[model samples]
Target: MASGNVSSVTEFILLGLTEQPELQLPLFFIFLGVYVITMLGNLGLLILIGLNPHLHTPMYFFLFNLSFVDLCYSSAITPRMLISFVKENVISYGECMTQLYFFCFFVIDECYLLTAMAIDRYVAICKPLLYRVTMSNQMCFMLIMGTYMMGSSGAIAHTVCMLRLTFCDGNIIDHFMCDGPPLFQLSCTSTNVNKVVVFTIVGINVLVSSVTIFISYTSIISTILQISSTKGRSKAFSTCSFHIIAVSLFFGSAAFMYLKPSSTGSVNQDKVSTVFYTIMGPMMNPFIYSLRNKDVHVALHKALKKRMFF
Candidate 1:
């Protein structure tokens, strides 16, 4: 046991989604396309929000932050995964840890941010009279700050705990990225404490965010139902529909990936689930918000027309 605890591996080889040689190039092109779309879509949205004075509101403010987070989040994992497709998929121990930390940070940030967005929607829809006062500029800034702080604290906690564990097991990481569960499997030291910390932090983040969203939407739905006109109700629902879809896709895929018991046979399934949230989610968010949003479409058209005219 002591021998096993002695450090021998300095780097780990990532198996990267599949061991099939034939599939590697195809998956590479697929994810490269996804990454390209993720960058363009999110960046375009950010630029649109920044330039359009009409979009300078509390909702787009939160969206600006969301797009930034999604950009950073996807960059943290996707670039490295892309590299794995073409090169020898080896990552240094320190590099892997850094990747894990940022991945956790952005993911947790997103969870809380989505909750904040839900709260924003609730205040706007359910308490329109108080929306201006309740979601003032200072208040929105503080909420965004708090989300980052919570995410940083959680990431720090997980990374610090993981650092204490010694990894002397074989140097192959089964998944494409250096995630908690797969990394834990490589640790030769007792991982009970690490597991406990992970479960506690993740459970709290997911639970609190999920509950907040649930309560906010409950109020939002009730308020919408009270509207006397069908058109009014539809209008109200449309306002939150994009957010609802984004939240459902993010949480559903994440819950499927992290909440399940770790099993050796499920690595491929885990990879697929991870791709949904980390890769596909970011790619889809800008489309989800912009395609359904009239304001975004209007702003985009005005911007394009201005560019063409200039």
Candidate 2:
């Protein structure tokens, strides 16, 4: 029992986004504003989707999930960070793991959900009449459930692997939140197991989602080329462009931060790049989807009008 005792590290001091005292307040306000926008944007999108019956397709079903993910994702980190900026920047071990768990869950779920959304678009655009039949209510529900399960599996694997690693001395995490990469870096024990598990889980996530999006888009392009009307082609492209941009931002930054060995970059650089996916990506998601898509705009307007009249 004595030999197997895990060394206790109760609290971790976050090095935070920056070291400069002068920059701290400014950055705090900036991130605070970003968090506010993320919350409102995502919440607004959720309300819009739920209120408008017309937007109740598989596409908006996934978008609703995405809005939920964004809200949870931002809430997992931003509030704590705002507090830390004003005074203390410490997190208990249990709290850290909890944050890491949900953060991983939402983010990884987005990868799968986004892929599912792409496939939905592919079915809608390419298959047309078969869209309703192929992407039935049951099928959509199953897909959402499957995506959540996949996300939970990855988060559980990484967090469990992290639990095995001993953290004896240093308790500083050099990032805004409790993420896998930074947490793994602080372990006193050899992190080979954690690394292997993370790599395996993340690799499968990135690879499978990438391939799915690729196949979806490839077929989508083929379908578009067959359409003779320029207006029809443009409309189809517009509908997908927002999703493509969101995917590129989320996956591209995620790949850059996690796909490579940790030794290649400084902790500071790593923290900054992580901001893109963890923070900026969530902030941008609802904005990208809602602001750019006409259907979403229409839905938003109808919902607002009903609220105003009622």
Candidate 3:
């Protein structure tokens, strides 16, 4: 439909993680282990939260959503990556678009969701008396729904814009998956709309979410400082530390990757940055949340004890 000098690029060959034959087996097992851990940790968290009554709260509810996101996020890239390590890492145009769509959707959802979680924490810590009134079930549900809508909308915008471009040039996506930038690179057309959409979406999502986090943490820090007791401050800081770490890892990597000038950063550099959010962030999420959050630790302990006794 779209007019371009280049007409068709049916399938693409993915340049996987490595081409060094000697490193294949070791890398395969390492990723296999990472995937297994990601599945078990996230799945276990979800199940523990679902079964345990004590863990039924706004915090855990959002956490449950986060676990689900991490699970889907990892599945979107990791399984294919695993397979690629073993065999040919080739994907069709249709399949590549589908992967890009879902991957974009979940990744964007996480940005919004994490911002919402920060707001929730801000309410709980800074405005404890109004926590219930502020982060009510209805409100949480609405926030989650809004996040999903934003994610879907962004994904659709990117995917639709991508579809309009004629990929008549080259189809060699020089990375593990059909990432947004690499996909854009393969287009035979000018890709003006694609560039605009990418810039607008990335700018809006990152700017909005980052601003929300900054505001939330500002209030939170003020509240923490007002507490004269060192122990109290430490306790509050500890609770929020995990979230801050997660946010830093997720948003920092995203900002670095998406906010950079494409003309300045090479495609390979972009791909490397993408690996932080796509692979590293997901891998680190459960470890960060479970190990750092006291509530999750208690829930895990209680669940294990109950299972052993019963």
Best by TM-score: 1
- Candidate 1 residue-wise lDDT, 157-218, digit = tens: 99999899888878899988989888898988898898888888988998999999999999
Please say which candidate is ahead in lDDT: 1 or 3.
Answer: 1
Report the error of model 1 at residue 188, Å: 0.5
Say which prediction, candidate 1 or candidate 3, comes out ahead on TM-score: 1
Which window of ten consecutive residues has the lowest lDDT sum in model 3?
1-10
> Per-candidate TM vs. native?
0.96, 0.95, 0.95
**lDDT scores of the candidates, listed in order:** 0.91, 0.87, 0.86
Could you list the CA RMSD of all candidates, in the order they appear?
2.0, 2.2, 2.2
**For model 3, which pairs clash?**
6-168, 7-168
Residue 254's C-alpha lDDT in candidate 3?
91
Indicate the residue-level lDDT of 4 in model 1.
48
Q: What lDDT tens digits, residue by residue, belong to model 3 across residues 1-310?
A: 2445646877888877776788777878998898888888889889988988988889889889999998999899988777767888888889989999999999999999899889989998999999989889999999999999999999999898888887766767777888777778778788877888888998999999999999999999999999999999998998789999999989988988877887787766776678788877877887887786777788888878988999
lDDT pick, better of 1 and 2? 1
lDDT of 3 at 135: 89
C-alpha-based local distance difference test score of model 1: 0.91
Top lDDT: which candidate number? 1
